[model samples]
Target: MTTLARLDQFARERKRAWAEGTRRAAKIARERLRSACERAGQRLWRTLSRARHERARDLSKRVQHGQRIVKVGREHGMNVAAATVNLTRKAWRRVRGLRRPFVRAGRRVERLGEQYGALREEWAVERDIESLVDGGEPILFGPWTSEVGYEALYWVAFVRWVKMTYRLRTDRLAVMSRGGVSAWYADITPRYLDIFDRVTPEAFAARTAERLVSAGTAKQMDLSAFDAELVESARRELGVERLRVMHPSLMYRLFRQFWLGHRPLGFLQSHTSFARLTMPAREVRIPDLPAEYVAVKFSGAQSLPPTPDHQRMVRRIVGAVAERYPVVLLDTGMAVDEHGDFGIVRTPRIQSVREYLRPSDNLGVQTGVIAGARGFIGTCGSVAWLAPMLGVDTQAVMTDARFLHAHLHAARWVYRTLDAGRFSPLDLGGFARFGLDVAGASELLADRPS
Candidate 1:
């Protein structure tokens, strides 16, 4: 070997050894530093562990009644209310997953199961509806087992989608909705079967009570054996041997996710097709109705709770309207649901259609009155949902918005999308709290053609 070659090989070996030692030294230093940090963290954790236990106990006792708390911003100092403390403790107990990890995992599994079940129900309903439409048999749209608002707003719109999507023959479809509201489905079908014709209003009310008792809800979100019986009865009334059914449950199932906050508003838009409804035909007219009358229907229910204050508000509001235009009170003396008629003694200007209403045609009569109204003022549901479709300006009043927010949000959207009548909200709670003048509030109600 050449001398220079030997020298270069030795130099290369020394450089490689130096680099390997440097790497080893760096790795050992890192490991030692990590170990030291771990020890520090352990010491810190131990010190705070006792502190955390005591601090938690301190916090627990601090929020109790009779324990004066430092007031937060924009407030005066005060002791916590006993009820508030109890509610807080109850709320904390409800979050079991916070303390037990497995509880959270179990809850997640349950929620997943619920979602799967809902999806399965939705798919099953879609399949059933498609099958019924495909059978070439007449589709009986309803023994329509829902509120008037839902019927006018969501249910009818959803049915429009069904007709368009399936290319349903108008001749093969008949609506079995109560209240003589065949006019509401003018474009969908001409065959209108009134439930009142087959059954008396008293019998109808009894049947409705049975349905509600069985379902344990005011809304018909599910179709039960009672519903099947009604469908059968309706078919017999139509004198048809075999008729396919399209129940309100279809619309309820389609919009359940949206109502539950799992889906967006667009989900409803995708499923519903809205078209403005023509007025309930002039043939079913209210007798002796003034040309420029304001239709008013106030019920003591969720929106207008049956409180003395609410009653006064109702009277004052009606009085204010009666001054401007002759008032047509759409009051049904019959007991249907939990809601009751807010009894207003009729005057010459303030007249009720109760005398005009039959148990079966009560809602139909109300709808007709509202359709012919120059303007409508009512609790934030029922006929308020209908008046807009009939192109009358609507002023919907509500005290508690807990139940109304979802419907209001959708109603506002539907009104805008369909280019229907103007909808305005009258905050009755605000009026009660802030001493709003009923006369001033009534002044804001929009004017419509007489």
Candidate 2:
């Protein structure tokens, strides 16, 4: 090559190397600074804890004032109530160790991708629940003020039910009490549950399958087809492709046909405007814990696989882990009426422990709703998942056929859906007859064959 070309190449190499070195130095410096700040914060927290202890009586009164917000509007028949849990010393200790570090780590790592960041955030929240209790009395933590926060509370209770209900005759159970609802839930769950699978293109059109054929004027579309139409309409209306992608579901597809189309009487055929249509509330109510209930809720654990078999294995372990701890809490939402009569609030005020920062703003309101129970029962969804991580005993419920691997990974009392569906038979004598033995199932799950 010519001398000029060689000189240019060497100059470019020097510039690139300098830029790379500068970026590396900057990254290392930022990380160190972040760490230093966290250390300082922790030290300050310790100092404040000491100061708060000295003025415990006065501070308790102030806390009570904040707590009183829970009871407001309850008698107004608003169908929503505010509540929180009182964390035990042990529970507080556990949470303090995990929360801040987890958050900081998650924020730093999120540049990698949305899924990884989301998982980290969930993990941090789970850690908050784990660091709160010592296996007995409920650790109260919420000031569930908003609809969204209440939803998170409800999810905790629902997951608790999922875990504890598996071995009803058993003395103890565990559940989740914190974390956000997963998008994976929307993608999964439908394969098995009728509630999810029953949704069809006809339902989207506000017409029954029988009615679709008779009403020849009405257009029908498959899910994918409907998505295409919706995408075009969204692009036309918003002048961008991003808008089409932003709206995740087909709820908007019908919205466009009825509102944006040329038809003036679109409301007459619109799904939402239909006279008989009733959209089910997305979230369920959290049930109240019964006086006789001896339940435990745990959090702070990382979720395992996303496959079916691995999840069932996790559930099997949950049931066994919960055997040692009687009371459990969970973070799972239940579907309840918007009027709020069904879930964990069957009775008057009774204190329970909640263990997380009120992250209602992060997750939508009504993320997790649950109904009240005789005692606390749960499995990992929100709060209960964190419990075992904090060293609580949990009896996790496992199902072999779950779609998302995460749920199965968190299950303890593993149930084989194939066995439940008569694929795995107790006897070969009759093809139509299949017997299920819960104890045997438990035993099989417990046996980790090497």
Best by lDDT: 1
Residue range 376-440, candidate 2, lDDT tens digits: 22333343332232222323332322322323322221222111110121111121135433444
**Candidate 2 backbone overlaps, count:** 104
Check candidate 1 and list the clashing pairs.
none
Regions of model 1 farther than 4 Å from truth: 1-110, 434-439, 442-450
lDDT of candidate 1 at residue 425, scale 0 to 100: 79
Cα lDDT of all candidates, in order?
0.76, 0.31
What is the RMSD, in Å, between candidate 1 and the native fold over all Cα? 20.2
For residues 374-404, could you state the per-residue lDDT of candidate 1 as single tens digits? 8888888887888887888888888898877
Q: What is the lDDT of residue 281 in candidate 1?
A: 37
Provide the global lDDT of candidate 2 against the true structure.
0.31
C-alpha RMSD of candidate 2: 30.7
Task: Name the weakest run of 10 consecutive residues (lDDT summed) in model 2.
Answer: 417-426
All candidates: CA RMSD in angstroms?
Answer: 20.2, 30.7
Model 2, which residues run further than 4 Å from truth? 1-20, 23-377, 404-434, 439-450
